[model samples]
Target chain A: MKTTTVFTIGRQFGSGGRSVGRRLAEKLEIPFYDRELIALAAKESGLSETLFENADEKATSSLFYSMVMGTYPLGGGAIAGRSEMPLNDQLFLIQSKTIHALAEKGSCVIVGRCADYVLRDLPNVLNIFIHARMPERIKRAIENYGEDEKKAESVCIKKDKQRANFYNYYSDRKWDQSETYDLTLDSGVLGLEGSVDLIIAYDEMFRKTEGKKRMVST
Target chain B: MKTTTVFTIGRQFGSGGRSVGRRLAEKLEIPFYDRELIALAAKESGLSETLFENADEKATSSLFYSMVMGTYPLGGGAIAGRSEMPLNDQLFLIQSKTIHALAEKGSCVIVGRCADYVLRDLPNVLNIFIHARMPERIKRAIENYGEDEKKAESVCIKKDKQRANFYNYYSDRKWDQSETYDLTLDSGVLGLEGSVDLIIAYDEMFRKTEGKKRMVST
Candidate 1:
């Protein structure tokens, strides 16, 4: 039987990471999850999709409170004291649970929602971080997202900070920290297509090593 | 005329980054500078080579003082107040100058000595950071470097921290920070050969983009 490999991507805003992940999933013939994750989490947790969307990759004021009380959730489960958790924390737990379920179901590509941290224990998972230089990112924002040329730089910076805050608050690891990921690619240098190709190459090499390790263990 | 593209590698101890740089230089038919950079710097600055060897990638006590005074060097030249600088700072300036001179000469693979930071202004430079899992690094330290099994982990950690301190002190950027680099690869995942391949691939794509920009500008 063939083993499955799940890919989790954390990306900077306007870095083309989402496009890369989506294209990679298509190339690999796997399911891709991004904003689709919010709907899944909502359905699984019996929560409103809008709630997840609103709080998506945005840290809440109760972050400090949750951190102080150590109320973050890990793994898929119904927590004993989950009722007292903030809505943001509750949503995060639900999303994490959804990510866990998705990974268990089959090979897939998951973007953001701290999927890398969620699937940290799985040996079959590869975590990637995608970033680009500020100028290129700003240009991408302006071109792809139709962001205003004058405000695009600040918009990109703000979105990255929001993602970082959300990831840092929810996970034990910091966002965009190189050590936390198996590979970090500069989309500005590689371009979206090149990034996808490199990722596929890396994944192929990665699976071969994993196969050897599994054979040795078994 | 063909353009020169310098590659600067920053690495954790036991990551086989030195070997990777040397091998990459050989594959590309270019000069590889590691400890040889020390000799070049010594000759250029008329400083003792031992002084550079002693201060190599080891932050000095005056790091904070130099930071506060804004005495760090960036380009290839003698500073106005160079004589008054600490020995470590003087060595760093000399080394930075040597790096600048080497890069100016032709394409080369330079390992450590803050080559990435020194050559930051150059459009033809690719900055890479290589790291590996601690266990793998520890194992490599023991098997390859003849480090004692028990002390390998701490030795790796110490060397990495020393390099980080030196990089952080001399450059505007923090060591191992993902955004500071064009690419960061996990040797634990890709291994040395895979890393070298990925870098060459990225470099080819990067140069194509650079070539386009140059054509547009000219």
Candidate 2:
């Protein structure tokens, strides 16, 4: 059965979250959004793609600092009343709007960009956090991403910190905390394919439960 | 195939964790231990069952305070070198030993008492954390456990804090954190039966992956 559920994935770096999202979208025959969000946000906001890419997963204070120091440009956007906002804030707003629009359109998988928080009001959104052991994440960074072996562990740590700060700053909930999501999966233990399978199982169960709830309410 | 996998559950009060553990154990046809551990520890250590039940989930400092105030007794046990230890510590040690012994015997579902941390050295242990939202938990507390309607929420919160403190004080890892457990389930979202089904799915997947790893190693 085709589900109208939207899956929002928050993941640690090198935890195969992006890959899982992509594969899940494929299996579910739904659209997948990850880096594609940046381009979509850029298109919607009339901002440069490079600006959104650089602003991605960056905490607001750093952008504010750069804006204060006159090192960053307040890019022109088509949207009104957002010109004076920090670039990070502007990007986040546009991205959140884009995420809402995407979810409203249909069932899809969106990774990162605080889509969970953005679509918090939607009943069909399933927020998921994917994580792995530090050593396994570091190994994935080095082996899969082809990072310098010496810097892989640090890189993973840095990326996760950035994501955490970004998510925590934008959303009321803390990133990677199980309470913040509908489900949290350990990609390290489940493996990427296993994680996807588990998610599929959960999605089916979620749909069935939701169906029952709706039936009772009606 | 009859697989040997010990399931250790950490849970919030009123989250149906004990029920899930009992049902999972029955389905797996393995032994289930919750309050039963108190009796076992009492039997093994020659300490009164009341001591074990009272000392259960109480942090060490409170027991230490009682000892310093000359209110608590230093119960004699069959084990040596534990007479001088705080009652909480003694109970913890004895309970942990009981957990290790239970795990060594075969596959079993052990609930609470920091079994995940106690059996950290075991390869076939699956650490799970079960939780539910406050409203559902409070409802369950009042309806199932017959907690006072006005006091159910506070009771759930208080019990969870005690469990968290007991776990955090003894284990290197923090309780209720997703990373601490192999799987974390929201009974609030999954429902009790759904949670059990999901866990069964995960256990099967876990065993298959472990079997593959063993084959590769050999």
Candidate 3:
């Protein structure tokens, strides 16, 4: 094998990001995780699987808003118990741990759950963000989410906001910023297959370059 | 020569976007415009060059804020004359016209000034957004903008906000959003030369594909 390259994808809703990730993993013969990671986190955290799903890519935004407005009690200070801590935070920690564990296990593709931020310290990981122009996403939503155009766009926008908020809250870096990821591709232009091919090519080029660097150092 | 390819780049502040645009223009042997567009707009609008520079990528945000707050003089009605309209709107129109005129003239690279939004309707246009990670952008600011690290980050963030607001207010599409462009690359990942080369390759690929499409259609 050339190398075990890990990939983390951050993407806009309805952009066929998960589809591309799955296809890439298949083409690359690697494990793929999207909702599957949520399952693993649930298993790791010993929490109800439903809890993770409910909080998937979305924290308790209303609770946070109310707390900011001083309308909701925060239960306790910063030392709040695990049970007392916000559900979203608990979900994030378990998912973060699961992401690290997966990376340690082997090279694979992990989608969302802020895996880019969680595994950023690793040297072998490539973080990619996938998005399309709104019209394309709206078209994709019709196909993927089976929703009409207007509803799809609104849903897409809302989901992007929630995902951004989730990533921003948990990660030190802002979400979807160009620098946050190693590569940012508009799936709208390249299309899903092209995006997967680009990533694979990038991985090959990166590993070859790294191989040369290691040889020179040695 | 292959068909002319126009590129409009929308980028995050401190991402070395302008430099990349310049380098790409050189590599592609095409004309490049950044601040030059502002001068053209100033000429077109018969507005002071200083006004365009002052409002460059930042419409009179304070004026917009005041208008939003119902405090600014809105010139009596919605259909205000060019003389009574906000300085930002006049500048945008002139630049919009300039962008279209440039497209009609020949292929070129345009940076900022909402060029992507301005040229969105064109067939042979590639809208690329260049962004780097914050740490990388800070380093770039020191080298490119000659600012201290702390100030570089702050200025970068502030500039990004202003650019976003300027874009959001003027264009129907939102700024920095992935769907807003055809290609979004991380200059941090590919670096200047690599990014330019990538775009060239994409342009070639796009042209070949378009040739196939036109043949099939005919």
Candidate 4:
């Protein structure tokens, strides 16, 4: 607890990764960031919440591209060609900076936002990925997102693709790869509460060895 | 489990994945198969244990080439060009049959051997991939394998490559990709026991939901 620790969760769509991360943050008595990251980035960069929300977790979507390129507010004033930058890229930069700031403050669980890749250099950082079988994820999507079975299935694939593209675009490593993470668990099998318990118990080992530099990480 | 279930683990070298898998099998009161698989295949196929061991978990390596092929026992009879088959390929066929037989018998935990891909048709199977960061894996390699720091790191890479190549050559999917697995966990952060506990807890949920077939799986 003495050392600053950051838990970054990378997850599949409808996998309850965000919920489990929030529960883990609460159990650890640390701050949790999910959608609040968007708001923070919006505030920090003088960008509108709508822009952040539209660009949130989406990569190179035609809807966002057509509507957000030059139509959205560019804040109070901007340098030339600022509008030329892709909306997703701009939003991602702001959120990445916000994630770094939040990580520096103290211990926290930051969900999505490519937080794992952003903070990969830190020894105190633990990157966890939560995923589940297709059927389980579809069930969660139906229960939580109020989508019907067919819609849930399609939406799940689309959303995960967006997240993968978004993460892959910004990070050096491939998104959702097990090697890129410290721990990967199936939320479908463990459920949200069960996942929280596993993370807490696992993080204890990390807490004990946090400050000790095991070896030079390349 | 009310109905039979098989837990298949795919792991990186020196990641404690094999140890954790053995512990999980013990905790679940199920059979554990690792090197024992090679022994079983040798017995079932009338091949020498040494032949199986030499070809065990190994990919197409020229270093192991010329030494195993056609030199080992081809059993009591010859099936014409049977000796022409690479020793690793022969071992793999026997091991694959052994894995299928083990899964059919009852619940068990089978490590490596591409059991995940081999049993893809089974609804009662769970495929898990275990990996850890390079530094943690390197430290484990040094402590467990008695290799120096540099040797440990290099050995880690080589072993993982062999495992990956073996899995990829035998299985339909890539070895360690997250999508190929039902779950992936880091034993480095969780330690062997912690990893076992997590698997057990996660499998408990699976036990409850399994055998019921939430939907008709084709």
Model 2: lDDT equals 0.81
lDDT of 1 by residue, B126-172 (tens): 88898777777888899999999999999999998899888998887
Docking class of 1: acceptable
lDDT of 2 at B134: 72
Off by over 4 Å in 3: A42-51, A60-88, A147-154, A177-179, A208-218, B40-51, B61-81, B148-150, B208-218
> Could you tell me the TM-score of candidate 3?
0.78
Off by over 4 Å in 1: A1-3, A63-81, A146-150, A211-218, B1-3, B63-81, B146-150, B211-218
TM-score leader:
2
Each candidate's chain B TM-score?
Answer: 0.86, 0.90, 0.85, 0.86
Worst ten in a row by lDDT for model 1 chain B:
B209-218
- Steric overlap count per candidate: 0, 0, 4, 0
Ranked candidates, highest lDDT first: 2, 1, 4, 3
Number of the candidate with higher TM-score, 1 or 3: 1
A112-161 per-residue lDDT for model 4 (tens digits): 98888787667788888887777878888999899987788899989998
The alpha-carbon deviation from the true structure for residue B61 of candidate 3, after best TM-score superposition, in angstroms, is 5.3
Please write out the lDDT profile of model 1 over residues A5-29, one tens digit for every residue.
8999999998889999999999999
Clashes by residue pair, model 1 = none
List the global CA lDDT of all models. Answer: 0.80, 0.81, 0.74, 0.78
DockQ of candidate 3, scored on C-alphas against the true complex (2 decimals): 0.18
Error of 4 at B60 (Å): 7.4
* Whole-model lDDT, model 3: 0.74
TM-score attained by model 1: 0.84
- Top-down TM-score ranking: 2, 1, 3, 4
Q: What is the lDDT of residue A92 in candidate 3?
A: 81
